[model samples]
Target: MIDVLAPAEAIHAAPELGAVYLSAFGAPGYDEEPARAEEFATEQIPLHSQRDDFKLVVARDAGKLTGFAYGFTGHRGQWWSDRVAAAVSPELADEWIGGHFEVVELAVVVEAQRQGVGAELMAALMTDLPNRKALLTTFADDRPAPRLYRRMGWKVLVPDLGWDSALYGLNLGVPLGH
Candidate 1:
């Protein structure tokens, strides 16, 4: 089963989360991703722990941690992104960095890769999200992610364009009785 975990103060006070993340992605030689992940886990995670715009969702099978997905809002002035802050909608581009839901990270363990855990996590995240539109990035040739997003009726804007990364999106309506 998958559940969206509330980021508590305890979890944010240690490096275990980053350890797990590094284990999943593998720490290569000093590179951009490692440095970036380091900054994200340390610098931003604590903020996320306290912000309404951020969430961390985890997937467990038989009580063991298998994967997680993290998301937060994007706003206009501080729309923090490595790429251009293009809007999923017409106004998203010009919006504040912290006002739109943006998926910051997602991953599944190797043993759990084909088990639909990612989909389940996404569904649960969608169930808990505070908005209808979400912005996210994934590898262009990612065998299953893009395909699954497409199957789920997500809109794909800004094609690969031969970039190192590709972005995909979904809209989660914040509705009552979720």
Candidate 2:
């Protein structure tokens, strides 16, 4: 089952969350730098959980973590928001970045992929969110992450941001790609 966890609860589950993150994102060079990946997950998960508008959804099966999704409300001064703001036009920045929810991370264990776990985590995290829109970035290559976002109605706001990353956005109240 998937459940929304408060910041404290999420923080307490940081180890499991970090494991899941490492399992999902650790590949190739990451395999050679496991400590770096683990360190990033350790630091980021708890820190993001502390944000006021932070939201985290975790999928558990028989008491084991299977997947997770997390994000926070976007504001002007945020590093990600500022970077995206500079990349997009003023109008688009206002429409998508200003007061939007930034989906910082979403990952599922390899064994849990293709079972709708990611989608469920995403839906649960985004549900009832007060933000009018949401934004996320993912590798621009042929990855399941981008496919899932497209299937869920996210549109490419920036197809390629020069680092093999693409920015995607979704208007909460509208149809996909609108």
Candidate 3:
């Protein structure tokens, strides 16, 4: 089962969850790698989430965390393309992490991969949404993540290698994408 959780509570599992995120993304892709500092990345998440636009969803099965998804509304200095970012983002950039419903993170435990946990988490994402779309990003083909998003009807709008993550849009209240 999956449930939307608060950042405060979600942070409690950070060390464990962080380990997982770091492990998967630590060395993803063949010739590309993140250029940002790990400390900065780690700190930005919990801190950025303090904004009102930030929301996190956690999935647990029998008391064990299987997966989680997180995102916020608008963010400042949109890196990829302000126009494209605004189109797919949950909220305006000035709204910061909490302004929009941009899913910054989503992961299922290694042992739980290939299960329906991820899909369940994503389903939970749209349960209360009023927006027509939402943005989610992940390493381009680093794993099955991008493919899964595509399978769910998410389409890539901004192709940014510098972002090191592929940006996707989900039509929340509309028919699945083509």
Candidate 4:
């Protein structure tokens, strides 16, 4: 089952999460460098955990970490938000950049792919976000991640934001219920 983790717990589990991230993205079809796994787990996750409204969720089966997803509220001055803001129009930046839940990473081990793990992770990640919407960037091709986002009602905000990536947005009307 997928369970949300408090920031402390997520930080504590960063090492294992790094392993899963490495395994998932290092597999064929992802362009990430394998060396980044350690850095992401040790540095990025820990730093991101300090952000406001940060959240992380991990899926475990038979005590093995199968997948995880995490994000935090986006704000001005952040590197990613700034870069995205610069490329997009003032209207898009105004509506979808700051204050949105920025989905930072979602990964599932190769063995867990195509089994609804990604979908479940996303649903749990966005179920009750304080933000009115969420955003992410993924490869601009017909990949599983992009397909899953589109399937879940995320619209394409920018066909090519940069680095061969596409920006996506989801207007989360009322966080599951009023």
Candidate 5:
């Protein structure tokens, strides 16, 4: 089942989560380096957990991690938000940058793919967010992540924003479950 993780729980699960991340993103196209997973667990997750409004959701089967999604409230001056804001037009930046929830990572182990784990993780992570909007970036292809986001009503605001990726936005002011 998918469940929300408190910051402490997430921190505790970092090692296993790193393994899951390595397995998931190691898929054919991503070519993610093995050490990146270690950094994600040791550096990124812990740092992000300190952000305001941080939220994380994980799915486990038989006590093994299958999938997870996490995000936090975004604000001006943060590196990611600032970088994205600089890449897009002022109007687009103003509409979607700060005051939004930034979906940092969503990964499902290869064995768990196409079984609704990603969708469930996203639904649980995004639901009940106090922010009026949310944003994420994914490769600009017809891949599972992009398709899942589009299927859930996330709109592509900027194509090829950087690294051949696209910026996606969701209107939380409207109802979810799309």
Candidate 6:
């Protein structure tokens, strides 16, 4: 089952979360980078936890962390928002980037990939967002992550947003019966 963790709890479990992150993205070239995969798990995840609206979900199998997805409410002047805004027009950025939930990261261990863990983490992260919309960036190539995003109804907002990535958005209209 996937479990939601508060910011503090997520921080406390950073080692476990970092292990999952390393197992998921510890590919070649990543090791040569100064802020390598381990840094992401140790530093980046904790930084994400500092967001006022940060949310995290983890899937466990036999109590082992297999996957995770996390994000937070977006606002003007944020690093990600500013970067995306530069790649798109003001109107488009205003409509999609402003005040939306930003899905910063979603990853599953290699052993757990293609088994719906990523999908579940994504659905759970966006299911109850207070924001009416959500956005994320993924590799521009036809990778499994991007395919999963498309399957979940996310539309490409910027086809080539630099860094060989594309920006995507989803309208989380009023929930049923709301």
How many residue pairs clash (N, CA or C atoms closer than 3 angstroms) in each of the candidate models, in the order given?
13, 0, 12, 0, 0, 0
**What's the distance in Å from true for residue 79, model 1?**
5.2
Candidate 6 local Cα displacement, residue 151, angstroms: 0.4
Candidate 1 C-alpha error for residue 151, in Å: 2.3
lDDT (tens digit, per residue) of candidate 3 on 1-178: 7776677775666655565455445534432234332442467667756854566777777886666777666544554336444544455333322234577677676677788777777767656764546776676654688877887788776555354666676756665434
- lDDT per residue (tens digit) for residues 11-115 in model 6: 888888877777777744234243465687678878888985899999999999999999999888899988999998989987997789999989798899899
The CA lDDT at 49 in model 5 is 89
Could you tell me which 10 consecutive residues in candidate 6 have the lowest summed lDDT? Answer: 27-36
RMSD of 2: 2.1
Residue 19 deviation, candidate 6, in Å?
A: 0.9
- Models, CA RMSD each: 4.5, 2.1, 5.2, 2.0, 0.9, 2.8
Indicate the residue-level lDDT of 16 in model 6.
84
Q: Please give, for residues 118-143, the per-residue lDDT of candidate 1 as tens digits.
A: 77777666665666577776666756
Taking all chains together, each candidate's TM-score versus the true structure is 0.73, 0.91, 0.70, 0.95, 0.97, 0.91
| lDDT for each candidate structure | 0.62, 0.84, 0.62, 0.91, 0.92, 0.85
Q: Model 4: runs farther than 4 Å from truth? A: 174-178
How well is each residue in 1-178 modelled by candidate 4, as lDDT tens digits?
9999999999999999998899888887775686799999999999999999999999999999999999999999999999999999999999888999999999998899999999899999998889988999998988889989888888899999768999999889933212
Model 4 lowest lDDT segment of ten: 169-178
Candidate 2 vs. true structure, TM-score? 0.91
Better of 4 and 5 by TM-score: 5
Best-fitting candidate, scored by TM-score:
5
